[model samples]
Target chain A: MNATREELSEKGKKRRDFITLTATAMGGVLAGSIAWPLLQSMNPAADTLAESITEVNLAPILSGAALTVIWQGKPVFIRHRTQQEIAEAEDAPMSALPDPQTDKSRVLKPQWLIVTGICTHLGCVPLGQKKTEPRGEYGGWFCPCHGSHYDTSGRIRKGPAPTNMIVPPYTFVKEDLIRIGESS
Target chain B: MAKQSQNPYRHPFVRWIEHRLPIISFFEHTLKHYQVPKNLSFLWTGGFIAGFMLVVMIITGILLAMHYIPHPDHAFDSVERIMREVNFGWLIRYLHANGASLFFLVVYMHMFRSIYYGSYKSPRELLWIIGMIIFLIMMATAFLGYVLPWGQMSYWGATVITNLFTAIPWVGDSILEWLLGAPYVGAPALNKFFALHYLLPFLMFLMVFIHVWALHTNGSNNPTGVEPKTAEDTIPFHPYYTVKDLLSITAFMVIFAFFIFFAPNFFGEPENYIPADPMVTPAHIVPEWYFLPFYAILRAIPDKLGGFVAMISSILVLFALPWIDRSKVRSLTFRPISRALFWVFILDVIILGWAGAKPAEGNYIIIGQFATAYYFIHFLILVPLVSRFEKPSGLPESLSAYYKNSCHD
Candidate 1:
C-alpha cells in the first residue's frame, strides 16, 4: 500500500474502494454519454420531423406502376400491386427470404404495397419505381448502389440488406388517397 | 526468437509473394499482432476518429481538386459549378469542409486526453512531439484548403493570414513575397495554396506513420497512467482495438453525416458564399472555428509582431509541457489540483475562442488577454508549482490493481 492507501483505516479503505469503483463506472457511462448524441443526432432533426406528413394521390398510379413520394426526406414507394405480383409475393416461400416477413404481415391492404424505397443495407433508394429500372432477380426493387433485391412485398430476397424495406406508418384517408407519417 | 517465420502466410500465393515483399507479415506485426493496454478508455478512440476524418478529407479533396479551377476568376465559378453541375459534388464539398472541423475536434480531444493522463511525460515525449508535428501539418492543410474556395472569406482570410508574416522584423516583406510568390494575394498565391493544400496531407500522412511507429515503440498509456507489467494487462490490437475503433467510428460517422446532410454550412461563414472581393473585406472577418483560439491569442497582444509571436508561442508552449510538469505521477486522477486546473485551462481556451469569434474590442480584448495569460500560466507556472508542492500520495502501483480493483492472480 502507498501513503494514502496505507493511512486509511478499514472503513476508509472500503469507502475509497467504493469511490474508485463508482469513478470507473461513471467514467465508462460518461464516455458512453458523449457518443450517444453522435448517433442520436443522425436521427431526423426538427425540420424533417416537422415536415413529416405527405399526401399522395393513388388515382394516377396505374395497376402495375409504382409512384415514389417524399415523406420526411425519404422516398416512400407506393406500388399499385398487379394481381399476379400480389400472388407471387403471397405465395413466395418463407425459406427464400434473407429477412423473412409474410406478405400478410407486410401490408395493411392487398392492392397497395407501400414500403420505404431505401435499401436496408445502406440508405440508397432501390430502382423499381420506374419502368426502365431493373427490378433485380426477384422482380422487385433493385438497389444500384449495392445489389440488394426486394420482392413485390419489399422483402429482402438477396444481397447485403439485412431487413425488409420498412412499411412506413401510413393510412388510407380516401379510397384513392393515402396519408404518410400519421399513425394508421 | 526474432528470426523470420518461413510460413507466416498459410496460402501458397500469399506465401510466394511474402517471400519477396514481406507485406503480409508487416501487416500482422504492426497492426494485427500489435499489443495495447486492455484498460484503454473510450477517450482513446479519438485517434481513430482523427484517422477516419483524414481519409474522408483526402478522398473528398481529391474529387474536389479534379473540378477546381486555380485562377481567381474561374475558381469561384468552378466551385459553384461543382455544387450545381457535378453529381454528388455538394456532398463531397460539404464533407471535406466539415471534415476539417471534426478532424481538429478529435485531434484536440486526442491531445487533451494525453495531457489529462500525462501521456506526454518521460518515455513518451518523442511520441507526443511526433503527434504535434502531425497537428501542425493538419493545421497547414486546413489553412490551404480554406483558400481553395476563392470566396470572400477565402481571399480576405488568406490576405490577412499571409500579412501576418509581414509582422516579422527586417525580412518580413521578403518572407511575405517568398510565401505569396507575388506582391498581392492573387493568382500565384491561390495556385501555391492549391498545390500545397494537395501536398500537405501526404506530409501529414508520413508524420502519422512515424507517430504510429513511436506509439508502438512506447506502447499506450492506460487510464490509470500505469505501464503494463504483464501479458494480462495488454491485448492484441486486432480484435479488441479494431472492434472498439469501429464502434467509435460508427458513432462518430453519425454526427459527421448529420452535419453533411443536415447542417452542411454549420461551421462555414456566410461571407464565404460570396465570391472573392479584395476591395471590400467582410466587416467582421474571422478564421475557421478550429483556428479561433489561436486567432484570439494573436489579437490579444497589442503589438503586431508580439501577437504573431504569442500566437506561435501558444502552440510551442505545448512542446515544453512534458518537461514543465514536475509531478512524479502522470494521471490527474491522483493529482486533484492538476485535474481541477486542467478543466480551468479548457474553460480558458473556450473563452479565448469566444473572444476570437467576436470582434476584438473593449471587454473582449481584456478578457482574451487574461485568458491568454492564464493559458501560459497554466502550462508554465501553475502546473510546475502545484505538481512540485502537492503530493499525489495514493498513486496506484499498477494498471491492473487500480482498474481491475484487484491484483491479477
Candidate 2:
C-alpha cells in the first residue's frame, strides 16, 4: 500500500517481492552465523570438557539408595531404586507433574534411575543421597537451597524448578560398571 | 529521513551501504542535527561530562579487572601487586577509584541543576525518574566495586549494609544469609559482589540508552525552563554544544589529571589500605563521602528498622520531586523564597554528611537529627507549601527576549 501506482506493475511487484524474500532469508542466515560463536563459547569450556566423561562403579550402590558422582563439576545422582520407590514413581500421573517424566522412560534398567542432582531452577544440588537427610514429602530429593522437591524419577513434582532433572548421556559398560558423558 | 540523492556527503560506496544499513545517516540525523536550546548554561553540560566519565570508568575497569582476583585469599594481594608491579596499573586503579567519586560529584551537581531549574516538571517526569534510578544503580555498582578490594572499609561496609536486610520481619534473616551466601561476608559474598559489579555497568549503559532516548523524545529542559518556540531559539547539537561540552571536559580532565598524578589517595580512606580484618573492627566506620548524607539519616533514628526505612526513604523521596513541588513556575530564578530554601537544603545536606562521618554520639547525633528533620521538612512541607504561596518575579517573554535584554546589559 505504501508503494506508488507507478511502481505497481505486476512484474515489478514480483521482482520486489523476490528481493524482500531473499533479503529476509539472508538476514536470518547472517544473524545465526553471528550468534554461532557466542553459543559455542557457552558450550562447556575446556576444563569442563576435560572432566565431562566420568566412570562410575555401580556395584557400591544399594537398593533404595543413591550415590552422587562428579561429572563436569556437577553432581549426578545414580539411584538403585527399590520396588516401592519405583511403584510410587510409576503411580504418579504424568499430567499432574510439574515436569512430566515416566519412571520407566527415565531409567535404562528396571532398578536404576540416574539423573543430574542439579535443580532446574538456579542449579543448587538436591539433597537425598544420604539416608539421614530429608528426602522431602515425595521421598526423593529436597533442595534445601530453595525447597524444590524431586520425585523418585527425578521429575520436578513441587517448588520452583521448571523441569525434570537432566539425564546425562550414560551407558552401562558392565553389570557393575557404567560410563557417563557420551551417548551410545 | 535522509535520502541517498539528498545526502551531500554520501559517496557511491556509502550510498550503496546506506541503501542496506543507513547507520551513518542515523548518527547524522540523531546526533549531529539534533536541535537543542541555545541558552543552555555550563550546568547543562553535565550529561556529556557524565558520558565521557562512564567511558573512562569502563576502560579503566576492564584494565583493572584483567589483573584483579575475585577470591578473598588472593584479592587483597593481587590488588597490591597491581598497584606496585603491573604496567601502569597504579594509574588505572587510581582513575577508577577517584573516577567513582568524581562521577558522583558531577551527578550530584547535575541533579541539583535539575532541581534549581524545574527540569522534572510535567512531561519530563519519566526522564527525571530514570535519572534517579541511574543514581541508585550507580550507588549499587560502586558498593559492589568497593567490596572487591577486600579492604577494611570494604569488608565492614558490606557486613553492615547486608546486615541491614535483617531489620525485615519474617524473610529478613534468610535474605541476609542468601545475600552474604554464608553466615558472614566471606568468599561467597566476595565472588558474587565481583560478578554483580562487572554486570551493573552494562545495566547502567542500557538505562543511559533509555535516558538519552527519552531526552530526545521530550527535548532538553534549559536554564530558562521555557520550550524553544522558534528555530532561532535552538541550534544543532554538533558544532555548538559539542564544542562547549569538549571545552568543559578538557577543564574537568585538568583537575582529574592533577588527582591522578599527585593526591590520588586524598579521596580514599586510610583504613582501606589495610586488608579486611574480620576479627578487628575500626573505631569509626564511614561510607564513601557521596553516601554520607543518607548514612547520617540512617544513624539519626534510634530504632534499627526506623533508621533503615529513613535511609531508604531519603533516596526514594527524590522520585516524588516532579509532583511534590506544585509550582506553575519552572526555574527557581523566578521564585526567590524557593531559591533561598534550596541553598538552605544544600547546606543542611552538607552538615548531614559531616555528621555522618563523625560517630553517632553526643553532639553529632543531635546535629544529624536536626539536619535529617530539615531534609524532610524542606521536601515535605517547604517545597509544596512555598510553591502554593511564594510570589515569583516576572518572566522574560521568550529565550530571545532574555538574550536581547542580556545583550543590552
Candidate 3:
C-alpha cells in the first residue's frame, strides 16, 4: 500500500486525474453498450408488430347504414353516410366542436365515414353501430362509459373525450374494399 | 470498536482459518458485540421484524414464482392451480401474498418510528436515504409482483400506472410504450416485469446490508434521541436486544398468522379473482391497501401531469427531509408541538387511505383533496417551521443520565 501510494504520488495529480477520467469514460461506454440490448429487447416483438391489416368490403353497407369491424384488436366503425348526415356534418360550425375537424377532411368520399370506435376519453367501445343503439345528441356515437358524444363526422362534439375518434391508417384497396391498418 | 483479546486456547485449525479470512470475527462483531442504546424500547424491534419479513417474503416469493406462469392466459389459472393442486401450495401462496402487506405494514411503522424520533437527522441521513431507496425498490417490486397474477385489479392497475407516464411532455407516449413494451400491457410487459420483480429483492438485501453498516457507524437513535456518551449508556447486542426482538417477532407472527390463515384475501381485491379482460374495465379499481395513501394523492389533482408530479414529489420530498427539518432536538418526546403535529400527520395519511378506497367522485374527491393538501403542508411547511420554532424540553446531559442504568446488562 505504501509503495503504491508513493508511485501514485510520483505520477502527480494531473496524470492521476487523466487516468481516472479515461477509465471512467471507458467504463461508462462499456456499461451503456451492455444495457442497450437489454433495453431494446423490451420493445414490441416481431409477432406483435405484425398486426397488419383488416380488409372490409363496403358492398353490403347501404347508405345510412354502418358496419363495425375488428382491426388490431379494436373496433372500427365504417358508416355509409346518408346524404342528409353528410350535409349536416359539413354544415356544423367548427367553433362548436370540442375537438374540431372538418367533415370533408375526415372522409375520402362524401357518403362514407370511417373511425375507430374506441372512445378517446378512456378506451371504451362507443355505442352507435346498430340502428337500435343510442347515438348521442350529434347522431354519431355515444360512449356509455363516460358519455362522450361524436358528431356525424366522428369528431368529438361533447362529453369527456379529449379528441376526435381515431382514424386508423387505411386506404381503398379496391373501389368497394377498404383495408384498415395499411396506408398507401 | 473495542478489540477482542486473542484466545490462548489454540485450536490450530480455527486460528489458521481466522487469520486468513476473519469471517467468524466479522459475524461476531456485527451480531454479538455491537453496542446499541441501552434504553431502546420495543419500538426498536421494528427493524428486526423488517429484516425478518424480508427473509419471509423472498422465500415465499421464490416458491410462488415456481408455479406462476408469466403469460396472460395462464397467469390467473396458475394462481388458482397453486391454491388447489399443489399440496400446501395454498398456504405458501397466502403467506407470500399476505406477507407483502405485512412487510409494508412493518416498513411503514419502521419509517414513521424513525420520523417520530427524528432518526433521519445528521450522521444518520445516509442510512435513512438507503432505507428510502430500499423502500422505492420495495414499491416497484410489489407492483411488478401484483401484476404477475394477471387478474382484473392487477391488469387494470398496470394499465392505470403505466399510462401515468404518458402525462409527461414530448416523450411521454414513447416512455409509456417503452415501459409497457407494447402499445398496451401484454406478454412483453408481463415478461419484463416478472424478470425485474424477481431481481429487486436480492438488490434490496444488499441495500439493507449497507443500511445496517451506515446505522452501526452512528449507532441507533432511541426514544430519548440522546447520543450515548459512556459505556454505561449502551448495551451489547447478544442477549438484551436479541431476546427482546425474538419476543416481539413471536408476538407479531400471531397477527400475521391471523391474516394468512383466516383472512388470506383480506388485502386483495375480489375483482382480481376474475381473469383479466382487456375490453371491459371494472367500474372501480383499487390498489393494495398499502398503496392507498399515494394512490389517493395521485387522483387528488385534476390534471394528469400535475397528479403524477404531486404523487412522485410526496416520496422524493422525504429524501430531502434531513435537510428540511434542521432542529437541534432529535425526538418528538422533547418537542410537544411537533408531537401533536406528528399524530395529525398520521391521521391525515389514514384519511387519504380511506379516500383512496372510494371511487374518485362526490365527497370522496373533496376529502382526498383536503387530505392531500394537508400531507404536503405537514411535511414541507409545518415540519420546518415547527423544527425551527418549537421549544424542546431541556435534553438530558447524557443517555446514561436519562436512563440511570435502568437497563443494565
Candidate 4:
C-alpha cells in the first residue's frame, strides 16, 4: 500500500509539471503572436504616409489674376496671365532682375502669365502689382511686401527679395484645368 | 589561477593593473553572478531590439552627415547631389530615414513590453524612467534630423513646429527667434538644428548606458512578472539570455533588411522631393507619422497654450506611471481587469494616432478630445484605481514554489 501511494504521487507530480510547461508555452506563443503583428502593422502605415502625393487645382482664376492655396500649410500663389501679358513679359530686360529668362524657358508651352508666386526676400507673400502701375519697361506682378518689383516675366526687378519668384512645376489638365502638385 | 606566476614580467604593478581592469574576470563574474529568470520569453527581446536600433541610428546619422550640407542655399542641392552622384548616398539616406521609423517602432514595443510585464514597478522604476528619457531624446533628435533634407516637407514641418513656441504668452516671439537664431526658420535655424541634431545621439548613447545600468541594478523583469527569490528559480545570464537575445536580434534584422531593400521610399513624403519654397506652401503640412499622435494632442486643445500644455503633458505623464500603478502584481497574466484596461489604453493610443492624421475639424476635434481624456485617465486614474481594487491571484511563496508544488502534485 505504501509503494502504491508513492507511485500515485509520482504520477500526479509529472502531470502537474506537464500542465505548467504547457501553460507557459501557450503564454509565450500568445505574446509572440500579438507582438509580431503589432510590430508589422507599424511599418506599412508609415510607408504610406511618407510616399503619398497631393493634388492642387488651378482653374478658378482668370488671366492676370492671382489666387492663393495652402499646401502643407504654407500659402502658394497661382497667377494666370493673359496672352498680352506673356508678350509684354518678354520685353522686360534680363539685366534688371536677379534672374533673367525668356518666356519660352520659364513657362510651359502655351499657358503663360508667369506661374511663379514665391517672394524672393524672407518668404512672406508679396502683394500683387496693380494694372495701373507703369510697366517700368517690364510688366508683371510687383511684390509690395518689400519694395521688390517684377516685370510681366515674374523676374525680380527691384527690392530686397533676392531671387525671382519661383516657377513651380505644373501641367495643364485640359484647356482651362491645371494640376499644380505633381508633374505628369 | 596561479599559472601567471610562471611569467616573471607579470610583476606586482602588472598584477595590480590586471586586477583593476580585469575584463576577463569581470566577464566571468557577470556570467556567474548575474541571474536571469529562467522563464523569460521572447517579449524580453524588445528592449535589446530598441537598443540595437538606437545604435543603427547613430551610425547611419554620422555617415549621412559626411555628405550632408547644413546651409539652406546648399542643403537642397547637396541632398540632390547625394542622391544623384555621391557613392551609395541613396542607400545611406534611405537607411537613416527608414531607421527612424523602425527605431520608434521598436521603442514603442519596448515600452509596451515594460508595461505588460510590470517592468516599471518598484526597484525598476529608475530603469523605466531612464527609458522614457531615451524616448524623449530620440523624439527630439528625429525631429531635428527630419529638417536636414530641406525638402518642402522639411521646411514647412520646421515652420509649423517652431511656431508652436510662439504660443507662449509674453516672450513667445523672442523664444521663437532664439530657436531660429533669426526672425524666421531660415539659414540660422537650419544650421543650428543640424549642429544639435548631430550632438543629441551621443547624449542618447550616454542615457542608454544609464538605462542599462539601471536595468542591471534591478535585474530584468521576466515574463511571469514574478521576481526571482532564490538560485533555484534563476539561470546564469550568459548562455541562457545571450543565445535568446542573439536569436531575436537576427530575426529582427531580417525584417529591417526587407524594408531597407524593397520598400525604401515607403515612409518618405512625396512633397519632400520638391525643394523648400517658403512662399509656396504645400496645402497640408503634416509632420512625420511617428509624431502624429502627439501632434494630434497638440491640436486637440482649442487654445494655444492649452494645446501646448496638453501636448507636453502627454509625454510628462509617462514619467509618473511607475508610481501611479498601485498593483501588487507585476504581470498582466494574473490581473484580468488590468489586462482589459491595457487593451483600452492601446485602443486609445491608436484613436489618438488616427485623430492626429485627420484635419482638426468638426467631429475629429471631439474625437481627439475624448481620446486625449482617455489617455490621461488610463494613467492617472485607471492604473492606480484598478491596481488598488483588483484582487491578484496569490503568488508563489518562493522561487522554488513551482518545484515544490510540482513535487507535491
**Maximum-TM-score candidate:** 3
For model 3, report DockQ: 0.27
lDDT of 2 by residue, B1-409 (tens): 5564565554788777767787878888777889998988999989889878888898899999999999879999999999999999999999999999999899999999999999999889999999999999999999899899999888877877776777676887667666766545777678878888988888888999999998998799888787888998899998898899999999999989988899999888899889986644454678899999998998787555777899999999999998999987888988999999999999999999999988756688889999999999999999999998988886677767777876842
Model 4 CAPRI rating: incorrect
- What DockQ, on C-alphas, does every prediction get? 0.01, 0.02, 0.27, 0.04
Q: Which number leads on lDDT?
A: 3
Q: Which ranges of candidate 3 are over 4 A from the true structure? A: A1-25, A56-70, A73-165, A172-178, B1-13, B403-409
lDDT (CA) per prediction: 0.83, 0.83, 0.86, 0.75
**lDDT by residue (tens digit), candidate 3, A35-149:** 9998888777777767669999999999989988877655688999998899889999989987778987788878889898766654556778878877889899876643568
Off by over 4 Å in 1: A1-184, B1-5, B406-409
Task: Tell me model 2's lDDT, rounded to 2 decimals.
Answer: 0.83
Clashing pairs in 1: none
Give model 1's share of reference contacts.
0.00
- lDDT (10s digit) by residue, model 4, range B1-409: 4745532335677666555566555666666678888878788888888878878888888887888899989999998888789999888877888989988888888899899989999989989888899899999999899998899989978876776776677897667766776655777678889999999999999998899888878788886687898887789988888889899999988888888899987878899989988765555566788898898787677655677889999999999888899887888877889999999899989999988877656688789889998988888888889999998874566545744665742
Q: Which stretches of candidate 4 lie over 4 Å from their true place?
A: A1-184, B1-17, B398-409
Question: Considering DockQ, where higher is better, how would the candidates rank from best to worst?
Answer: 3, 4, 2, 1
| Candidate 3 chain A least-lDDT 10 residues | A117-126
* Candidate 1 deviation (Cα RMSD): 28.5
Q: In candidate 1, what are the lDDT values of residues B1-409, reduced to their tens digit?
A: 2334775667888878888788888889977788898888889999878877888888999999999999888999999999999999898888898899899999999999999999999899999988988998898889988998999888877877877786677897667666776545777678878999999998888888888888888788878887889887899999899899999999999999899999999999999999986534455678999899998888787666777899999999888888899887889988999999999999999999998888756688889899999988888889989989887856777777775464533
TM-score of each: 0.68, 0.69, 0.86, 0.68
